[model samples]
Target: MDMKKYRSTMKRILGCISRYQWGVAASLACAFVTVILTLYVPILTGRAIDCIAGAGAVDFPRMWKILKQIGIITAITAASQWLMSHINHWVTYRVVKDIRTQAFNKLEILPLKYIDSHSHGDMINRIIADIDQFSDGLLMGFTQLFTGVLTILGTLVFMFSMNPAITIVVVLVTPVSLFAAGFIARRTYRMFKMQSQTRGELTSLVEEMLGNQKVVKAFRHEADAQEQFENINEELRIWSLKATFFSSITNPATRFVNSLVYASVGIAGAIASINGLLSVGQLASFLSYANQYTKPFNEISGVVTELQNALASAARVFELIDAKPQVPEDPDAAVLNNARGEVSLEHVYFSYNPEVPLIEDMNLKVLPGQRIAIVGPTGCGKSTVINLLMRFYDVTCGSIQVDGTDVRHMTRQSLRTNYGMVLQETWLKSGTIRENIAYGNPEASEEEIILAAKEAHAHGFIRRMPQGYDTVISEDGGNLSQGQKQLLCIARVMLCLPPMLILDEATSSIDTRTEIKIQKAFSKMMEGRTSFIVAHRLSTIREADVILVMRDGHIIEQGTHESLIFQNGFYAQLYNSQFAV
Candidate 1:
């Protein structure tokens, strides 16, 4: 990520802090107090040492006073530190949860193009693994940063009071430690960033391969898959090692600078004590403060290391959050309630990529209650027709209108709710059979659900399940046969009973016998509704009220099936090829 994006990512973290300021403020305040109390202990300990080592015989009374002060400070330090930790944990997790929720909500509004371009595993990694790293590192990182800084500053005040000359050595040497940390940080951040991206690639590979594991096994591509995975994993290992190798350099580098500072302070203090410029007690206390002062550098350097990883992961997560959503919704959008199902495309032009111009200068109109079957070769804009009509991707130029109002005028919810769809690929969440059937109409009663299932011919097999409609379906409905899943999807659409319907190869997975049975059901259900069927099976759509033949981006022929066959154009060629086989 560039500096602009990094700053944007940090602003997001600052936003989290702002949102939960009360909790963070409490944590910061506790951290501040804890460091102050901790600094007091070292000063008190040195006082006791000077009292015993000087002329008096033990100075028992004075020693008791010093010990009591140290004990009180220690107790407060422990309590305050505990409070700071608890608050930090609460704020960290809440921020993480908020971030994940926002990302998911963004997905719902993002353009299909964005989702299509990104890998599923990469998206998942941002939500889960990257967010986890950010939370762990960011929470502790800020806490330590606050304490380390306050500890250094407080110790500096005392050091200067005891000996200004020695304070100069301490102050000057500290920057060497910081400079080393900064140099190492700059190098390690790039390494960690690359490692984070590699981890996402590995995750994407695993998700892709595992999802298609059956295909892999059937083709016996296990060795090739393994080889591919090993390559990605090896790349990840190299980046991870390089990141670790660079981050590891900071601790020793900071410690070494701090060691020099410690030795110089010790020598200067002893010489000052001999010259009577500093008392034994003051010299002891200054040395203690000097040691405490430099300790935070080592601690800060360690925190910085973890922080680099956090920042890298955070940038990835924020990338998703910051991504622009699909085209903005119209401000004064109208609603298409009680839809008449009259849809039209006027002077339409569209392309997945504008330069390619997959569709151009198209116009079409459909009356209510028409069963329109759109047929074409693969990639001939058959499915694209459904996509545009459903407003998944808006037309590049011109407008799509429903009920005489441009689709852009209607709220997508209002426009889409009027139509029901079942696509070539079936999707089912992990839920009960009944829930899957009732997906489009969650309020559908048991009788209504069963009636829809019977219409789609899924009721028979559903009854054979050990738990009937109550049986739970696994993810993607993997537990059921493809035909079973298709039937369930059809049943879902039937339950919705929208004014318009889209069946994009909806029955492709069913056996011919079952398909015929369901066709009969669909024929009856198509009454008084606009239905667009993108069918590959020529025989199945022969009864369509109108057959629209498409090639490239244009409809090459349009008429009833018999008329199209008589015309002997593209539709005739397609129909003859299928029937002759």
Candidate 2:
């Protein structure tokens, strides 16, 4: 519906195609040759038939020469078409490959907020399904589209040369076919666009349901889920049918109009032949040219349908590619090297939405090796603080500095690489346990990986598996228990030996006894390293040098546990509530 987006999408598709323009140019040349051969062969055949019609006597030598020419030209036309098909296919697939690569690379640099806001399954469709449709239509359009146009043009020029009167008849009826094709194409495009979007919705619904099958079964919502899926599936089916119906009408519409043109040319040519204005052989050639011209009208009408489908797919892909990244990294950003773990927030202000300000003019200073614990009720900005600290979302005002330099002045990768993080949500890729642990520091040795695993109490469980450290975990570690997955994630950070660490309810999945043991291990690990601990269980941070008690996005109280308990404020009451049970 947006003309500007349509133009932009077409321009980008053209750009990808132009990468192999030399090949495309060669293919076009082949197609042109094929068109000429097609026109010439028909002329030769018609001339042979006219030799007998005119003389009423067999001109054996002349007829044989004409037949020979026809045979050779037909062979050449077939070869030229083959070349065209080959070149078009090779160039088309390569262009598609480049497009997919660029799209995937764009995702890597895209802002997290964009990924979070967009449906993941819709994105998958753009990457896979939509691109495939675009490729198929593009390839067909490339070869057939150009060939049909040239055939029409070459045939028209020959028709005019032979008989201008019949040429006018051919041109007059051409508009009817064009009009029909254009009308049908417009409606088909709308339907195809709707179909593409509906397909994305269906894919997203499937992904969401499959990912949360546990919740659906636990809530006994099978029938409800099936109904929802059916609703989306039926919507996709309706749009798909409508699009197919509209496109299918095109070939028949063009055929009906073209048949009128074909019939008129035949009747007109016969009259011209009766008179002496056109020779018998020439009139025969003219009829062949008329058939040639009208046939392309049919082929091109079909191509129009394909072109619309391609453009619809291209529009979706270009929209995703053009999405602006979260925040651009500074060209002259500082490189953080061997950071000493000192962090300071100065007059910071932040909010997910500017109208509803959350963290307001906040200030915090952390020493190089201090163990800082941040505690608060749900939605009290506990996680927002970490998000800001990690520069996932920058402070709306003021600055967060690492080691003496503003975090904004450092590259995100360099800044984040220095800190190790373990969250309650454990993420494990499809790889062996050894690979997961060494993900942060790929160069870590086998000995270092084992030591880190042992410290997390994961070494024993991992060794008991059939393949030990080489056991490949399924996607999301579906084969492992929650606690085992959590331990593997912790072991990953332990191997990194980062300059700073953040534990965000990292032990929530483990049993109480195991959590206590891991807590002791973490306490030992924190002897000289700076750590940021976030917990609902205040008991875990009993030995923290400082505890920040947050309420409504501000630190309502700040001190050691004994000091905060003596104050008998929000921190003391919150700590007391836990033991009340």
Candidate 3:
């Protein structure tokens, strides 16, 4: 890990902790008391030892009194430790909650392009798994880190007061443990970071496979998927082992140095006792102080290992929280209200990638209440046009307007609320059928919801459900057939009944008879509303007032269906191919 980055992450971690200033102060005070009381016990023990002047000459009352004091101090120390532990938990979890909330909110405002380009599973891992890891590391830091440092400092002060020469021996030999831990920590951080990244990749792969299980099975790609999973799993395992190996050595290596320090203190103290520089009881106390001083090194080494994992996870989560959001909506933008839907694209240009131009210098105009149909082969910018019209992706150049007002000057919420959309891919949240239909207009009356469902030809199946319209659907309408799910989506749009409409293969999943019925219903609903229909089936758009035949992101032909057929152009060829038999 870069030392600079490590410091930066630590600073951010501290900044998060700074929010609960009172909690931190309370925890520190408890830790200070616990360490101070704990260190004082050894001094009382030394005095108790001195009171036992030989076997029979023991000062029984004095020994008993000292023992009582020791017992009282121990009880208080335990209570302080307990309070500190709880405080640490309170602060650590609150910080985790704040960071996780921030990360989630960032996702909400992120541009669709970022979400489209990244793996869903990886994003979920950063929000969930990485944050959990960070919390664990933070808990450990709050629990042991402060206490361990104080214990070390307190022990050194007590030891130096007892004997300066022995204190120097401990202080001199301590650098070896510090050096060992630091060396291991530096190498382990990079290994742990790689391990975290691999884990995210594995999660993404699993999520993709699970979500498309039907397609995977249809193609019999199970073995290939297993192979890919195994490859990523094996990579995660390797990195985990390497990180664990390096971190695991830290404890034993430090313990070995600590043991050597203990021995050196013992030998030096014994010589001083013999030379009449210290008493036997004082020597015992010095040895106790030496043990106390070195024990923190063992705890701190473990903390170092955990801290590396935590810091690695923190970096990943922070990356997500710090991602740039979509460009801010203008505060003073116009609010499109009851739009007349005179939509137009004026010299528009767009591409998913700047290097690979898809649409360029495109223009079109639609009068209010006109039913315009857009037909094109796949990858011909049909959907891209819809995306720009809805401001899901802004035009790379030029302007799109509604009711003669530049869309860039309109508030997104008001602009989107003016249009009702039904697409080939239907999405329904887990909820009752009534709730799903009312999703766009939550305040819609029950009668209104049922009327919309009936218009979409979905009321029959919805009434047959166990709870009628109140029947709850599983995620993405998993319990419903594809055609049934599409109807519910249509019903949702019908309930909204915006001034403008967009139907992109809206009836593709329904049977022909049902499609015809819904198409008639749609015709009535769109009687005086401007509507854009994108269809591959040429027969469905025959009644469209105008047909825009697009190819390679450019409009190659434009006319009514009859006129296009008379011209015998690309639209005629596309229409004829469907009825070739």
Clash totals in order = 1, 0, 0
lDDT per residue as tens, model 3, 80-180: 99999999999999999999999999998888999999999999999999999999999999899999999999999999998999899999999999999
Pick by lDDT: 2 or 3, better one: 3
Structural similarity to truth (TM-score) of each candidate: 0.97, 0.96, 0.97
- Report the C-alpha lDDT of model 2 over 423-523, residue by residue, as the tens digit: 98889999998999898989999999999999999999999998999999998898999999999999998888778889999998999999988998898
Error of 2 at 119 (Å): 1.2
Q: Order the candidates by lDDT, highest first — what do you get?
A: 3, 1, 2
Model 1 lDDT at residue 75:
91
Clashing pairs in 2: none
Please give the range of 10 consecutive residues that has the lowest summed lDDT in model 3.
48-57
Best by the lDDT measure: 3
Cα-based lDDT for every prediction: 0.89, 0.89, 0.93
By TM-score, how accurate is candidate 3? 0.97
Better of 2 and 3 by TM-score: 3
Overall local distance difference test of candidate 3? 0.93
Global lDDT of model 2:
0.89
